[model samples]
Target: MPRLLIAEDDADLGPAMKRALELDGYVVDLFARGDDVLVAVGVGSYDVILLDIGLPHMTGLEVLRALRARRDETPVIVITAFDRTPHRVAGLDAGADDYVVKPVDLEELAARIRSQLRRRERRHDDSLSVGRVTLDFAGHVASMDGEEVLLTAKEFRVLALLMRRSRRFVSKTDLEGELYDQDQWVESNTIEVAISSLRRKFGRDFIRTARGLGYMVGGLEA
Candidate 1:
């Protein structure tokens, strides 16, 4: 499931939007303060962000500016009651990927989110090959030497993150964050178990580990 963060100050509207987006097959996290949104993004990865202009602590635009300054290109959709041309332009200038005016229509918001996701996907190859293993991201399928290899949801997620960063070691903490949402309770050995399962399917050496560095798929010899 894709993860999303919503920064809206409207007490009633924020939770409502979160619930609606969850129903649309997304793991949604809601925050009323812009600073909190920044804090969440620091530790967690989100596929997209829904930011309201009128947020407490710091405004949405300020948060968006901070993200861009740090070179964080995660897609952000500005959701605000301000429908004026200046407001939209300000958001665009601040590096927002898209803007939606409030009284938000849930269906339209979902469509916009999908559009941004598709745009991001187009920036990368649909499939990645590392050694004898290949992962087709669009198809959500993994194969070894041209033969399809079945994988559970968790296994696929772990493999995808590793393969995407094929050259770098991915820490267990990063893997756990990607696998489970903020609200989900995770077992300490969850990532270890998943890695063990993946090694069984692909050869034991398919994923290499280094002390203190975490795991990697390809690049340097193990």
Candidate 2:
């Protein structure tokens, strides 16, 4: 299930939005403060973020700017009561993937989320290969040394992220967000388990660890 983080300050509207999105099958988290929204994004994984402009402590626009400043590409949709041209332009210019004016239609919100997710999926849809191991994402299959390899669902997701990012390090927190939903009870060592399993199948050098930082695809010997 897709996870969503909603930062809305209105007492009544926040809860109403949460319940509505939950009913649409999204695992939702609500934050009434803008700073809290930033904190949640740093520690939690969410497929899409709904940010309301009128937030306490910090405006949603400020929050969006901070997120983009860090190069975080998570899709964000700005939700606000301001439907004026300047507000819409400012939100888009500040890195919001989409914007919605208030009195939000839940159905429309859901559709927009789906569209962003689809676009994200397309970004990483290509088949990938490193050394003798090859991953066919379209077919949902993998092969190493000319033989088929079977991987658990979680394993595939880990491999896919690593492959797509290649040399770039993917932090544990980021990987966790992508691999599991917020509502799921995940063990602390869940990511470690997946990494260990991948190494066992593809060899240790297939993934390199940066001590306290994260994991990345290292140069695989041909």
Candidate 3:
């Protein structure tokens, strides 16, 4: 699950947005004050942030500025009622990854969030290959011997993490951390099941299971 931080001051809209995003499979932390946003972003590893401009105390622009000044590159979508040219330009200039004018369309907002997360994933794809198999982390794609191999969402997440750390053991605990959010109740065999699925798609040798160290892509010898 992707983590999101929402900085909107509206009592009604803030919780509404949070519920909508959580329903869309995001773990969201919401703040009604702009000053609190800076602190939240500084500590949490969020995939995206939804910031409202007309926030109390500090403005959203100031929070955005503080984030960028610290060299934090987390994707931000400035959400505000202000659709004015100057406001939009200022948010963009402050390093927002995207912007949306409120009365926000939740569907459109969800799509934009997905877009930003996809871009972030693509940057980290970096062509992880082992033997004849290649994993495209960003595209949620994998290919073997120049052919596309379909994978389930959980399968893809498992494979991507393993391939990113190819030839290195990925313990069950570490894999679980990446695959599920804190609120998600992971089954004891969840990783095992996803691995089993991947093995079916890529053959047994494609992913090696060490006796105790855990799962790895191919093998160190490959």
TM-scores for candidates 1 onward, in order: 0.62, 0.62, 0.59
Distance (Å) between predicted and true CA of 99, model 1? 0.5
Q: Runs in model 3 with CA error above 4 Å?
A: 127-222
For model 3, what is the C-alpha lDDT against the true structure? Answer: 0.82
In the range 46-125, model 2's lDDT, one tens digit per residue, is: 77899999999999999999887755667899999998999999999999999998899888988999999898777557
Residue 117, model 1: lDDT of 89
RMSD of each: 10.4, 9.8, 11.3
* Tens-digit lDDT string for candidate 1 (1-222): 788999998988899999999999999999999999988876566779999999989999999998887656679999999999999999999999999999999999999999998987775468766667888888999999999999988899899899766646899999999877642777899899999999999988888888898998764331
- Model 1 misplacement above 4 A: 126-222
State which candidate has the highest lDDT: 1
Model 1 compared with the native: what TM-score? 0.62
Q: Candidate 2 at 22: error in angstroms?
A: 0.8
Arranged by TM-score with the best first, the candidates are 2, 1, 3
lDDT of each: 0.87, 0.84, 0.82
Number of clashes in model 1? Answer: 0
